[model samples]
Target: MWKLSVACAVLCSVSSVAHSQSNVLLYGIIDEGVQFNSNAGGNRQYYLASGELNGSRWGVRGSEDLGSGLKALFVLENGFDVNTGKLGQGGLEFGRRAYVGLSSGLGTVTLGRQYDSVVDFVGLLEAGDQWAGYLGAHPADNDNFNNTNRVNNAVKYTSRSLGGFTFGGMYSLGGIAGDTTRNQIWSFGAGYANGPLVLGAAYLNVRNPNVSFYGSGGTVAPTTGGVPGSNFGSSPVISGYASARTLQVIGAGAAYTFGASTFGALYSNTRFKGLGDASSGPVSARGISGSATLNNVEVNFKYQFTPALLVGAEYVYTKGSGPDGVGDVSYHQGALGIDYFLSKRTDIYAVAAFQKASGTDSSGKPAVASLSQITPSSTDRQTALRLAIRHKF
Candidate 1:
C-alpha cells in the first residue's frame, strides 16, 4: 500500500507539472534599402530607407498552458525606423501590436491595441514582398491593405479553423465621453485555405475617421481644405476627403498556387462618406462635400525558379470619384520584384515600380503620380527602384 501510494503521488505530481506550462519568445525583422525616386516634391531623389518590404520590428510573445485545453497568450510588438533609429508608428512603444488573450477549442478572445480583421484575413493576399515593398501599395493604400492603421481600445474575437474556414471580428470603442458611436470602429472578415488555394474577404468601418484613424497617430493641423498634415504624408489621394465623417472599406482577394508559381488578385472599395466635417486638414480648399469613393483592382504573379530565387510582378488600377465638381481621377501602376534568399531568415531583393495618373485630384488640381513614400510627382508619371536586404530573427 505504501509503495502504491508513493507511485500515485509521483504520477500526480508529474501530471500536474505537465498540465501547466509557459513559454516566452523574442523575435524581430529588419529590412533596409536604398531607393531612387523619379520625382519627389518634383525633384529626383535617392535615399536609404527602412522597412521597405517589411517594417522593422521586434516583439515578445508568451503563452501559458492552463489545465483545461486552454491557453493565455500575449504579444507586444514594437515598430521602428532603421534609418533614423526612431520609433515607428508615430512613436508608440508597441505600435505594431500589443494584445493579450485566451485561446481554447472554440477560438480566441483578445483585448488591447490590435490589427483589424482585414489585415488578418485579406492583407496577405493583396501583396507580399513577392513584393510591393511599401512603395507598391495600391494608390494611397486607400483600402488599408498596407495596414496603415491599427485599432485601439479594441476587443477582438477569432474563431478556430473549421474545415478549411476561419473567421474573426473586432470592435473598438471610441472612448468619447457622451457619444457611443462617434469615433467607433468595427471590422470583420473570413478566410479559407485548402491545398494550394487561399481566399479572403473583409470589411472595416470607422466613424469620424479623420480623427480616429488618421489622427490616431497624434496631433494634426485642422482642415485648411487640402489634405491634413499627418503622418500618412501629404497626398492628393486623401486630400479632399480629409474631412470625411466616416470611412468604410471592403476588400476581397484570392490566390492559387500551382507547381512553382502562384497567381493572385484583389479588389477593394474605399469610401469617405459625409465629407467636409472640418477635422484633419485643408477642407474648404479641396472643395470636397458629400462623399468621395475609390475602387482598386490588382493582379499579381509570383514564380520560384529555385529554392533560393523568386520573382514577382503586379499591376493595379485605381479610380476615384467625389462630389461637387471635383474631376474624376484614375491611376495605373505596375511593379516587378526579385528576391534571393540567402537563408531562411535573411535575403536580398530589388523592386521597381511605375505609376501614371490622370484627371483632377481631391485638391481640385490635376492628379499627379504618387508612390507610397515618394512625393507627389510634378507630372502625371513616376517611377521608383529599390534594392534591399532583410533579416529576421
Candidate 2:
C-alpha cells in the first residue's frame, strides 16, 4: 500500500508540473456595423453593408514555457462575413492566420501559413487598414503588404528589437510537386518605432507571378482576356507563361503628440517590373515599366475630445501611371471618424469616407465611364458612412 501511494503521488506531481508549464487561451473579436455607399452602381446597388469597420473573426492562441527564456506559440485565426456567414480567404476554415513556431531571446521563427514581413510591418501605416481590401488594395494586394491577406505554405522569421528597430523575412512555397520554380515568393522588411516616430520599409519579389496569379487563385481573373492594359493580347497560358514580377515598396510615417491631439503623415511608393511578353511582341510592349509606379500620401489629425471620446480625420491621395504610351490616373480620399469608449476593451465608432478618381482610360479619352469598372476607380467618387460597435477580449 505504501509503494502504491508513493507512485500515485509522483504521477500527480508530474502532471501538475506539466500543466503549469503550458497554457492555451481562446480569444477573438466580432465587429459588425451598418454601412451605406452612395455609388454602388447597376444591379449591385449599394445597401446595408457588413464588416465595414472591422472584420468579424475568432481565434485560438496558446503558448508553452520551454525552460530558460524559450517558448512555443501558435495562432489560428479565421475571418468571416457576418451578413452571409461565409468564410473569407477562399473558403479555408482558418484563413486569416494559422501558424506555429518558437521564440527565444534572439528572435522568433514560425512555420505554416503566415503573413509576410512587409504586410506585418508596413500595413499598420495605412489609413483605416486600407479600407479597400480586395476592391481597393494597391496593386490589389498582389504584393502581400496590405494586410493578413496572403498565406500558403509559408515560413517567417522576426528578430528581437534592438534600439527600437526590428527586422523580419518570410518565404512561401509554391507547393508544386516536383517543380521548385513554379510560384515562389520571398520578402524582407525592417521597422523602427520610438517615442512619437515610426518608420518602415520592405521589398518583395514574386518569381513567375503570372503562374501564381492565375493558378494560385489571386484576385485577377484569368479569363479577362489578356492583361488589363495590353492591346488585344491573347490570354497567356497558365503554365506556358513566364513573367518574373518584382515589387519594391518603401513607406514612412510619423506622428507627433501635443497635449490631447496628435498629427501624422505617411508616404509610400511601389514599383513593378517584368510584366510584358517580349517573345511575341515588340520590345516596347516588353520589359519593366515606368508607368506601373504608384505613389500615396496621407495626412491625419486625431483629437481626444474627452477621456472616452476621440475624433479623427484623414485625407489621402494616390497616383498610378501606366507605361509610356498608357495613361495616368489619380485618386483622392477623405475620411472622418469618431470613437466612444464604453470600456477599456469595448467601443463604438462612426466613420464617413469619400473617394474620387481622375484619369484617362485605354482609349486615350477621359476614363470617367470606366471608373466603376476599375478596382480603385480614379473617377467613380463614392461616399461611405458606417456606424459600428466592437468588443475585444
Candidate 3:
C-alpha cells in the first residue's frame, strides 16, 4: 500500500509540472487612421490606412518549458490592411512573421521566414522604429537595417547578450531547383547597448534581385543596357542578366536622456557593387552612379510631457549620386508625432510627415521622376497625417 501511494504521488506531481510549463497567449493590435497627402499630385486625397503608429497585427505566441533552462517557442503573426481588410506581406497569410525555434541560456535559433540580422539590429536604432514604418522608411527600404523587412526561406541564429552586447546572423536559401545560386540572400550584424549608449552595424548581399518588380505589373525585364559607357545605343534594349548585387552598410547612432527628454543622431552609408558584367561584355553598365554616394543622416528628439503623454520629432536627409554626366538627387523629410498612453498596453497617437525629393533615381537619372511616386512621372513631394488607437493583448 505504501509503495502504491508513493508511485501515485510521483505521477501526479509530474502532470502538474507539465501543465505549469505550457502556455499559449493570444495578442493583437488594430490601428487605423485617415491620411491626407498634400501633394498626392493628380488628386490630394484622404484615405483610411493601417499601421499608423505601428504595424497592425494579430498573432499567437507560445512557449513550453522543457526544464533545465530550455524552452520551445513559436510565433505566427499576420499583418493586414485595416481599411481594406486585406492581408499584407505579398498576400501570404502570415506575412509579418512565422517561425518556430528553441531557446536556452546560450541563445535562440529560429527557422522559416524571419527578419534578417541587419534589420533586426539596426532597425531598432532608428527613431520610432524606422519612423512608424513604410511611410517613413528610407527610400526603397534599400538597406534592410532601416525597415526590418522579412526574409523567406531563412535560418537565423541570435546569441545571448553578454555584458550588454549581442550578435546575430541569417542565411536565406534560394530554394530554386537547378539554379541554387539564384535569388539567394544573406546577412550578419551585431549590436551593443549599455546605459544610454547604443551602436550597431551590418552587411547584406543578394543575388539577382528582381528589380522589375519595382514598378508596374512586373513584366519589365531587368536590364543591363544601363551600364555606363556601354556601346548599346541610348535606351538600349537589353534584357536583365543574371548578376550579383551587393550592399554593404555601416551605421552608428547615439542617444542621451536628460530629465524627460531624449535626443539622438544616426548616420549610414550603402554601396552597390557587382553591377558590371563579369564576362567583360560591355562592362555590363556598372558604376553609373558616378562620383556621388548614398548617404543618410538623421536627428531626432523625444519628450515625455507626462507619464502618459509623449511627443517626438525627427528630420532625415538622403542623397544619391551617379557618375560624371549622370545626375544626383537628394531627399529631405521631416516627421512629428505624439502618443498618449491609455494604459501600459494601449495607446492613441497622431503622426504627420512631409517629404521633398530633388535628384535622380537610383540609376542616377534626372529628377524628372519623383521618388515618392514609386512610378515614373510622379511629383517629388508628399505629405501624410495619421491618427490611430492601438492595444496589445
Candidate 4:
C-alpha cells in the first residue's frame, strides 16, 4: 500500500509539471474600412474594403517545455475577409501560417508553410509596414514588403539575438520527383536593433516564381493551365512578366527614433530573368527571352501627437529598365495616414495615397499607375483615400 501510494504521488507530480509547461493561446485581429479610388477601371469608385490597413487574421500559438532549455512550439494562423466572411490566401484554411518547430537557447528551426526571411526581417522596417501599410508598399509590393505570398513546404531557421542582432534563413522544397531545383525558393535575412535605431537586410531567390508563387499553390502546379492566385487581383504592376525563369531580390532598410517621432528609409533591387509571354500563363516567353531590373527607394516619418494619436507620411520612387528595346518605367508615389487609438484593443484610422507612372510594362504596353491590390487607372496617375477601424483580441 505504501509503494502504491508513492507511485501515485510520483505520477501526479509529473502530470502537474507537464501541465505547467504546456500553454496555448488564441489571438486575432479584424480590420474593415471604406475606400474611394479616384480612378478604378477609368471611373471613380467607392466601396467597403476589408484589411485596408492590415489583413484580418486569427491564430493559435502554443509551446511545450521539453527540458534543458528546449521547447516544442507550433503556430496556426488564418487570414480572412470579414466583409465577405471568406478565407484569404486563396481559400486555404491556414493560409496565413502553419508551422511547428523546436526552440532552444541557441535558436529555432521550424517546418511547414511559412514566410521567407525577407518578410520576417527587413519588411518590418519598411514604411509600408510602419506607416502607410499596403497603400505605401512599393508598386505591386514588388519587393514583398507587404508579404503577398507564403512559401509552402518550407523549412526555416533563426538564430538568437547577439548584441541586439538576429539572423535567419528559409528554403522551400520544390517537391518535384526528379528535379530538386524546380520551383524551389530560398532566402536569408538579418536585423539589428539598438537604442532607437533599427536596421535590416535580406535576399531572396526563386525558381519559376509564377508557377511556384503566383499559380494555384506553393505546391508545384502544371506550368501550363494553372490559374494565378488573387494576389494578382487587378494590379498590373508586375503581372506583365508573371512568367519568369527566375526572380531575385535584395533589400535593406533602417529606422531611427527621436523622442516621439521615427524616421525610416528603404531600398531594394528586384530582377527578373528569361521572361515569358505576358498574355499566356506563367510560361516561357514566345520569342527572345529578356530580363528586367527594378530599383526602389523610399523614405518616411511618423510622429506621436499624443499617447493615443499618431500621424505619418511617406514617399517612394521606383525605376525599371529592361534589356535593349524593352522600354523603361518610373513611378512616384506618396502617402499620408493618421491613427487614433480608441482603446488598447481598438483603433480608427485614415489614409490617403497617390501615384504617377511613366514607362512601359514588360508586355511592351504603356505602364499605368496602380496601387497594390487595387485597380489600375486608365491614365498614368491614381489617387486613393481610406477610413478604417481595427480591433484586436
Q: Best by lDDT, which number? A: 1
Q: Candidate 3 on 97-179: residue-level lDDT in tens?
A: 88999999999999887877667777776665733444555554445444434677788889999998999888878777997
lDDT value, residue 16 of candidate 1? 80
Cα lDDT of model 2 by residue, 238-307, tens digit:
1112232434456666666788987777677755455354321122323433325557777878888898
Candidate 1 lDDT tens digits, 99-214: 99999999999999998888889988976434777777888778888887788889999999998999999999999899999889999999999999999999999988777777
TM-score of each: 0.92, 0.80, 0.80, 0.93
lDDT of 4 by residue, 1-393 (tens): 999999999999999999999999999999999999999989999999888677899999999999999999999999899989989877888988999999998999999989888898888887777657788889988888778878888999999999999999999999989989888999999999999999999999988777666653433334334543222335666766665678898999999999999999999998877776433245324343678888999999999999999999999999998765453789999999999999999999999999999888655678899988788899999999999999999
Better lDDT candidate (3, 4): 4
Model 4 compared with the native: what TM-score?
A: 0.93
Candidate 2 — which residues are off by over 4 angstroms?
A: 42-46, 130-148, 177-181, 208-244, 277-291, 361-379
Runs with alpha carbons beyond 4 Å of true place in candidate 1? 1-20, 128-130, 218-232, 279-282
Best by TM-score: 4
The Cα local distance difference test for each model comes to: 0.85, 0.60, 0.64, 0.84
Lowest lDDT 10-residue stretch of candidate 2: 231-240
Predictions ranked by lDDT, top down? 1, 4, 3, 2
The stretch of ten residues in a row with the least summed lDDT in candidate 3 is 231-240
In angstroms, the error of model 3 at 317 is: 1.1
Task: Please list the Cα RMSD from the true structure of every candidate, rounded to 1 decimal place.
Answer: 4.0, 5.5, 6.2, 2.7
- If both were scored by TM-score, which would come out higher, candidate 3 or candidate 4? 4
